[model samples]
Target: MRLFLKFIVVGFLNTVISYILFIAFLSILNYQASYTLSYCLSIGISYLLNTKIVFNVNRSIKSFLRFPLVYLVQYIFGFIILYLLNQYTKIENHIGILIVIFLSIPLTFILSRVVLLKKIQ
Candidate 1:
């Protein structure tokens, strides 16, 4: 429960920061470009918070690389589910995206825990 709470806190912060960056980048660039840039920026923030606060792990090169891989999984998972949701239903794109983001949380938490905490002392 405590670790979950930490995850939520860090996750919420990451989401808000990333959203701001996304909107800012969107105003100056195309959607794909904006998202890619913001996603890359947010990866650093998320990895630091998850390591130092959420999972209490030391910063490591291996963990740093693994962190983005976890998000890549989340991104792919979100993309597939969002695509299916949009195809089979009348859900709007923004709504579908939000749903996909929420749906990806548990998986994100599990995978991140595995990546960050599984080898701890």
Candidate 2:
């Protein structure tokens, strides 16, 4: 529970940063492009926070390399959801992104735990 809470906190911070970057980039880029750039940039921050703060694990080159797998999964699902919402529904890009972020939290936490805590043999 505590670990989950920490993940939530870190996720919240990450989301804020991503959202801000998305909005900033929206001025010059398409929504999808903005989202992709922001999401990719935020992955590094998410990895550091998840490893050191949420999971209390030391950062390693190996873990860092593996970390983005979690976000890649999240990004695929998130992009699908975002596309569906934007195309089929009346939801705006900004609101659709919020929905995607909320839905992704649990899956993100689980994947991050598996990747970050697994014993590498």
Candidate 3:
């Protein structure tokens, strides 16, 4: 329970930072790079925070390599879901994104715990 709460807090901070960066880029540059750049940057930060602070994961080279792989999978999954929601639904983009983000939390927790933070067998 406590760990889950920590995950929410850390994830919220990380998401806010990345979302701000995404908006800034969109507002200033008006480029078609909002989804990719923001997702990557946020996920990277999230992975680091999750492992080191949220989970107190034991650091290792293998863990470092695998963590990014897990994130890449999650990133791709998140992007596809968000894009589809934005295109197919009447909901606002941010709201749709939030829906998708919230839905993925359980899946992400499973992946992070089983893959990144799991004690090596």
Candidate 4:
């Protein structure tokens, strides 16, 4: 319960950071490129928060290296959902983005918590 709450908090913060950066970059770059940049930037913040706050683990190079995979999976999965929603429901792009992010939070939190907290050995 506590972990999920923490995850939601961090995820909301990350989503704000991501959307701001995405819009900023979107003006100068293509949609996919802007989204990629924002997503990557959010991963850094997410990693720090998840390690120290949610998981109560010290930062590790091993965990950091693996961390992007979580976002990568989330990104791809989210994009698919966004695309489907857009196709079927004519949802606005930003709204689709929000829905996608909300849907992805659980899987992203689970993968990071389980894999990032374990010992390498």
Candidate 5:
């Protein structure tokens, strides 16, 4: 129960950070980087928070290498999805952002459970 709560809190923080960065880059900066900037920034923050806060992952050689690898793959998939949605949808940017947020729930949970939270063998 505690772990689940921790995950939710961390996940919520990550979502806010990612969404803010996405909007700022896409709307304000007018940087048509196509989500790359947001993905890089948010993924880094999410990995850091998830490792230290949510998982209490101790810094170790194996874990360090593996954790980032898992995050990279997950972020790639997430970026692709977000990009495709932005391209294909008629939804407003704000609504599209919200849609992406909901869409991320299962992917986030699965990746966090199966990869990030999995016991390192």
Candidate 6:
């Protein structure tokens, strides 16, 4: 429960950063493009916070390399949800992203925990 709470806090911080970047990029790009760019940029911050704060793990080149895979998977899942919501529902891009973010939190935390905490035998 405590770990989950920490993950939520880190996720909230990452979401805020990504949303700001998305809004900035939306000025010149479409929603999909903005989301992609913002998400990619925020992965670094996510990795840092998740490692140092949330998981309390030491940074390693191996873990850093594996980290973005978690985000990539999350991004794909979120993008599909975003697309579906925007295409078939009344939600707009801005609002749809918030829904997607909240929906993705659990999956993100689980994947991140596996990648960050697994010990190589």
Per-model CA lDDT versus the true structure: 0.81, 0.92, 0.73, 0.83, 0.67, 0.93
**lDDT order of candidates, top first:** 6, 2, 4, 1, 3, 5
Could you tell me which residue pairs clash in candidate 4?
A: none
> lDDT winner among the candidates?
6
RMSD each, Å? 2.7, 2.2, 2.7, 2.7, 3.1, 2.0
Q: Please, what are the lDDT tens digits per residue for candidate 4 over residues 1-121? A: 8878987887888789999998899789966677778888999999988888878887888889988888888889977897798689978766777888878887887878777866422
Off by over 4 Å in 2: 119-121
Give stretches of model 4 more than 4 Å off: 119-121
What does candidate 2 score in Cα RMSD to the true structure? 2.2
The C-alpha local distance difference test score for the whole of candidate 4 amounts to: 0.83
82 Cα displacement, candidate 5 (Å): 3.3
Q: What lDDT tens digits, residue by residue, belong to model 5 across residues 1-121?
A: 6766787888888888877788778775543363567766776687778778877766566665566565576666666666676688766665666666666665676666556656532
* TM-scores of all predicted structures: 0.80, 0.96, 0.81, 0.87, 0.73, 0.96
- Which model is ahead, 1 or 2, in terms of lDDT? 2
Off by over 4 Å in 6: 119-121
Clashes of each: 0, 0, 0, 0, 0, 0
Runs of candidate 1 exceeding 4 Å displacement: 81-96, 119-121
